[model samples]
Target: MQKEYTVTVYTEDRIGITNRITIIFTRRGINITSLTTAETEIPGVYKFIITVMSTREKLDKVVGQIEKLIEIHRAFVHEEDEVVYQELALYKISTKSLESGDIERLIRDHQARILTITADYFVIEKTGHQQELTDFIKKLEPYGLIEYSKSGRVAIVKWSRRFHEHLKELQASSEA
Candidate 1:
């Protein structure tokens, strides 16, 4: 059965690394739903958080191919429940809308914050699960929502003890 999987990849920060990783999925016709990349706790190492819908069998093969890349340190496929994750979304709305009391109530109810207010428009920021962010979008539409964007998933594996140990080993080996 096909289900959503979060593929976490750790790699050395190098040019073309992302292109190489995405090409693996492209060849297999797997559509990446979302992709986030950023530096990790270890300097010079970066992490890619990719979301895709595929069977575990196929995902495993994809991960293997990713691991074969020169700069990749490791690649992991995790079921949704196996990781803790969040997505950030920002909404731009007309400043006029904020004048209404109902809009204030709505924002407060959703626990979203008004990031900036100006004469023309204001920005609202929200951080939550994908569904929660989308739901918030729906509520803001009637209030003159101008634009919106969401970041890809940022996640940490629920069971990361082994991962930490592996990183330590890599550091030790590199220092020798």
Candidate 2:
């Protein structure tokens, strides 16, 4: 089954860096579900968080391609359960379709903020995983959807050093 994979790329901050990364996806005939890039803590360095849907083999090939890029310093693929992740979603829903009290309860339950409100519609902002946001959409569907937007997954290793240690142990056990 095709599953979502989060790819993190660490690279030099230079012109066309984004284009170079996107080209890899394009060449592989993969579509990026979501992408976010920013400067890293270190000067002259940048980080990109890209979410894509593919099989395990495709994911591995994509990582290899990313690492081969001249500007990319490192590239890693993270399984959903192995990483800490979050997504920001903004949705405009029809207020007329829901009871005020029910809508208020949903807003509080999802920890969403109301950004704007019209007589018929209200914009709600939420932050969580893809599943959480998807569930929220289903619940609010009764209220009618006007528009929706979601930011890509931003993730980091949960037990960063532990992961490295586990790899080392596995290698040692295999070689013995």
Candidate 3:
């Protein structure tokens, strides 16, 4: 049976690394539902959290293939229930089309942050699950949406009290 999986990949920041990683999934016939990449706290390293659908066996193979990439430092699949996840979405609305009262009500109802405002448009930012953002977009579209951007899901497994020990182990292995 196919199950959804989110894999976190840590790799050296180099051109084409993302393409190489995604190509592995494409070759295996797995479609990526969401993929996000950003620089990690460790300088010159990038992290990717990719969401895909596949059986456990296929997911494992994908991770193993990612591990073999020259630029990749580590790759592992995270259990969804064991991780914290969030996504960011930003939408710009035409200020002339919506009344301030209605706009405030919508923002309050959705818990969105007012990012900026000009005479013509208002930019709002919201962060949460993908479903929340989708619903928000639906509600705001009628208000004359100008633009939008979404950061794909990013997640990290909850760390235990012995997290430092695990980090040390990872550092040692990487340095070896």
Candidate 4:
């Protein structure tokens, strides 16, 4: 059986690293649903958050292969419930729609905020899981949405001690 999984990888900053990491998934014929890469709290260390649909068995193997890369410091696979995640979405809607009774109602109901208002359109910003963000779109359609953009998922593993903490633990064990 196949289910969604988020694969998190920590690596050193280097050129062409994204391409190299993605090729691993491509060669395995696994379709990546989302990919986000950003620098970690420590400079020169980057984290890659990737989502895919696969069985636990397949994903475990994928993580192993990812860690085999010389640049990778660590890689782990997580089920959705094993992590905390969020995505951000922005919607641009015609200002005229605001005139329609209670546009404020939709905004409040979705817990979204108007990012900016202009002569033509106003932008609304929302952050949540994918389904929540998609739901906001349906609620906004009647208000004459002009544009929509969403950022890839960002997540943190639930059962984690900081990566640095883990490193310290390893060092302690080695010294003992």
Candidate 5:
């Protein structure tokens, strides 16, 4: 059975690494639902959080191919329960909508924050799971949603001790 999986990849920060990683999915015809990449706690190392819907068997093979890349330190495929994650979404609504006081109530109810208010529009920010963000958007549409965007997932594995130890070992080896 096919289910959603989050593939986390750790790699050296180098040009073309993103392209190389995406190409692996492209060749296998796996569609990426979302992809987020950013530097890690370890300097010169970066992490990629990719969401896709695929079978565990196929995902394992994909992770193996990703690990074969020279720049990649490690790659992992995690079920949803194996990690903690969040995504950020921003909504821009007309300033006029704020007059009703309902907008403030909505923000407070959803635990969202008003990022900025201006003559023309106000921006609201929410950080949560994908469903929560989308539900917030639905509620905001009636209040004059001018625009909205959501980021890819950012996640930390539940059991990351092994990865951190691996990084420490690499640092030690490099210093020798």
Candidate 6:
């Protein structure tokens, strides 16, 4: 059966690397649910976090192929349970909706907080799983949701303890 997987890749910062890495999935008919790229602790190095739905066998092979890319240093595939992930969502609603005060209750119940309140709109921020963010949207629909934005999945492998060790290994290998 196919399941959600988060593929984490460490690589050197270079142009077109994102396109090159994503094409591998595109060719395999894998649809990416989320993609996030950012700098790593190491200077000139970067990390790519990709979320996809596929079977373990296929994902293993895909990860192998990703590692073969010239710029990729390493790639790993993780099951949902193996990683702790969150997405940040911001909701902007009309200030007129607050007169009822029900919106305040809903935000507190959902563990979301108001970030800013202007004469026209108020913004609420929530950080959680995808389903939670979607649920919040449903709850806010009655409040005249002006804009809703969410960030890509940011995750950390629950069992990862070798990150530093792996970085050292990469450094040593690059030096040799």
Ranking of all candidate structures by their TM-score, best first: 5, 1, 6, 4, 3, 2
Candidate 6 local lDDT, 73-146, one digit each (tens)? 88999988999999999999999999999999999999999999999999999999999999999999999999
Better of 1 and 6 by TM-score: 1
Q: State the lDDT of candidate 3 residue by residue for 1-176, as single tens digits.
A: 88778888888888889899999999999999999889865556677999988887898999999999998877888767867999999999998865656877888888898988899998999999988998899999888898988988988757532543554566678789
Tens-digit lDDT track for model 2 on 108-174?
A: 9779989988888889999998889988988878778888889887777665565446445654776
Expressed as tens digits, the lDDT of each residue in 1-176 for candidate 5 is 99999999999989999999999998888999999999888888899999999999999999999999999999999999999999999999999999999889989999999999999999999999999999998899989999999999999999988888889789888989
Segments of candidate 4 deviating more than 4 angstroms: 167-176
lDDT of 6 at 139: 93
Which residue pairs in candidate 1 collide? none
Name the better of 1 and 3 by TM-score: 1
Instruction: Tell me the tens digit of each residue's lDDT in model 1 across 1-176.
Output: 99999999999989999999999999988999999999987777798999999999999999999999989989999999999999999999999896777899998998899999989999999999999999999999999999999999999999977886888778778889
- Superior candidate under TM-score, 3 versus 4: 4
Query: Which candidate should be chosen as best, given lDDT against the real structure?
Result: 5
Query: Per model, how many backbone clashes are there?
Result: 0, 0, 0, 0, 0, 0
Off by over 4 Å in 3: 98-100, 160-176
TM-score of each: 0.95, 0.76, 0.85, 0.92, 0.97, 0.93
**Deviation in Å, model 2, residue 37 alpha carbon:** 1.4
**Residue-by-residue lDDT tens digits, candidate 4, 1-176:** 99999999988888898888888888888899999989876666788999899889888887889899898889999998999999999999999998875788889888899999999999999999999999888888888989999999899888767776765565577679
Q: Residue 2 in model 5: shift from native, Å?
A: 1.1
Lowest lDDT 10-residue stretch of candidate 3? 159-168
Against the true structure, candidate 2 reaches a TM-score of: 0.76
Q: What's the distance in Å from true for residue 16, model 1? A: 0.6
List the candidate 6 regions with Cα displacement exceeding 4 Å: 169-176
Better of 4 and 6 by lDDT: 6
